[model samples]
Target: MYLHLTGTHLRLLGSMHLFPTTSRRTPPWIAEAYDWADTLVFESDPPTILPLLSANEQGSADRLRPFLPPDAWQHLNAVWPAGGSLAPLAGLRPWAAMIVAPTLFQQVVEGVEPRLLRSALTQGKPYQYLETAEEVAASLDTIPLDAIGAALALLMTDLAEPQRTLERMHAAWLEGDLPAIHRIALESPMFNLPGIREAILDARNRAWAARLTSLLARPERTLVVVGALHLCGPNNLLDCLAHPFEPVPDDAA
Candidate 1:
């Protein structure tokens, strides 16, 4: 799957399975797309981490305390427990930890792309990446630290709204509703920060679009899995590709 660097959509896609419930059922087009593919392509380089948290880093959680809403703060403490250090989050890069903490507080499961990678390996499907981990990190670095902090504060202060938005986005994805996905992308908080939107989405989309075109030149059937967000909006990867692949209807599966 062409994954967004953050693995957000990875979780959404990976959770989809058809048998039990639609909540996580694999969207019909995704399953159908994969069924004929012999190769898988990812959007980023291999994953790695930078030291954003460490046991010795004092006031880690304290820095965020003032920004967190009462309920969010309560959830944070519930995860880390009071009087305990922020050691559990020490291994993650600061940005990663920031992204993860809110999801954990909200009890959302993520990292579906990594699981897909493992499955591809086990099934002996060849795979390639469009960008390296270093490149992805560098793009993230372009977003000012203050912006990151502000985004985190927004996440903490109004948790419910974001969660609801995500639910809607997930539903749109499952239905293969590209227009809905595009609408959400335009409204997403990331778009509020022009620098970040350019770095993380636009630039990467352009690069991936080029790579995807090259891959399409090959004779083998390829399954391209990417973050749903990348496929939406004007100038997005989907728009950039010479041949657009439409999603099959859920009922058509």
Candidate 2:
């Protein structure tokens, strides 16, 4: 079964059931998928690539410094000194910086993926990754620095807001609302950048579709989880798979 952010939120909500319920919520399909799967395939990088990327990212920091506007550069340096290897804003390529900014924002707001990964471990389900960190990083690197700069500028502004965008996304995921997910995804600032849609979404979707096809040839029931955005629109993974896609059941949530 192919799951998306719903799986992430479900895993999180499932894990949290051990503690206080609080405000956590999950769609029914996520639970259904988790129960049915014999193996779990995570749409993530291999474990070993993160540390290597961190080391290499700092070396590109000086290269990116000249591209930031004077005010943006000053603000970034003030917030994150260049001397720090993992300084959030400094010493990173534009694409890497763009990726990091939203990640940090999501951290503050809380995310489903971390909790979901924890649940997978606790369940002792065998897990596999879809790509290496090097491959993922290389794809992001294909994005032009100018495009990344534009994305970063918009991101900085969005960060100042109350993050209504994230709230909408989370709500949609919890409700298994695909239309809302597609709408929000299409309207994202990232789509405004040239080649980004193709590089990050379409191309990756095609690659994943091929991988998933190979997995399907095996007899073992597998649960595939990826970002919610990759499941919508033309040439999306679901479409590329040539499967008859169905909308989430109204009662599923």
Candidate 3:
């Protein structure tokens, strides 16, 4: 989805982190926004958050297994036949595992955030992150162990469904069907867990909105690319923005 500040050279893009390689071409609107902006913004920096994603102790798979249902562990291995990506799980907290599982879908090209970051570096466009690594870690720490176990159980059960869900989400994202993206995403096992929706989505949206309000005072033409959910669903970032902005089909007027 696309949004423009009602009366300034500011733009917002509801970014899908990953897309199927078959559709590897960048969307026109995204390129337009990238070209228009003097600076860009994203959710958080990945490398800075890597440490927080790891557990204090190693052998996370062995440690996590006791808490997970037997069938879920069986299914997790079944889904991860190679154990290439699975190795990362051995040291990750459940919440971190959830974040890492996005590639479980299949045949995804590089995620848009990384691609844009690379471009920003190559072309000399300055950029910034909405949340620091510490902030992201704090948000994730809200997840209790019991909820993690429940989420892992559902994540393993019928992995095929998650694959299909990702495809459906990608399609909706390409079509700019904001409502469809929000509905499909919220249906995930993680979101359904107690208190997770607030911890992961709503609270972050509020925090991002506050950061973005200050950003509005900057003179640079800007493009902010955050997750699609942050721009769509109820209690979304756009709605929380203290400054007025409106969706625009093209460039900001």
Q: Pick the candidate with the highest TM-score.
A: 3
lDDT of 3 at 243: 64
Q: Which residue segments of model 3 deviate by more than 4 Å?
A: 57-67, 77-90, 251-253
lDDT of 2 by residue, 33-148 (tens): 66666777777743564454452633564456555676765655555535444565544655656655554444242244455567789999777877777778777667776676
Tell me which residue pairs clash in candidate 3: none
Q: Each candidate: what lDDT?
A: 0.54, 0.58, 0.76
lDDT tens string, model 3, 56-175? 543344466776898887766565535443455656666776656545756777667888899999998999889999898788777766777777777676556666777788889889
Clash number by candidate, in order: 9, 1, 0
Q: Is candidate 1 or candidate 2 better by lDDT?
A: 2
Q: Which pairs clash inside model 1?
A: 1-225, 2-225, 2-226, 16-24, 16-26, 17-24, 17-25, 17-26, 45-131
- Give the lDDT ranking, best first: 3, 2, 1
**Model 2 lDDT at residue 50:** 49
* Highest-lDDT candidate: 3
Q: After best superposition, candidate 3 residue 122: deviation in angstroms?
A: 1.0
Predicted structure 3, TM vs. truth: 0.88
Please give the TM-score that candidate 2 achieves against the real structure: 0.77
Global local distance difference test of model 3: 0.76
lDDT of 2 at 213: 63
Instruction: Report the lDDT tens digits of candidate 1 across residue range 1-253.
Output: 2222221111112222112122544444555555556776766544343343331233333444455455755654556523333345433344454545545434344433565677778888887777877677666555554555556656656666555666776777666676786687566554564565677678888877677655555665556666767766767776675453433344532
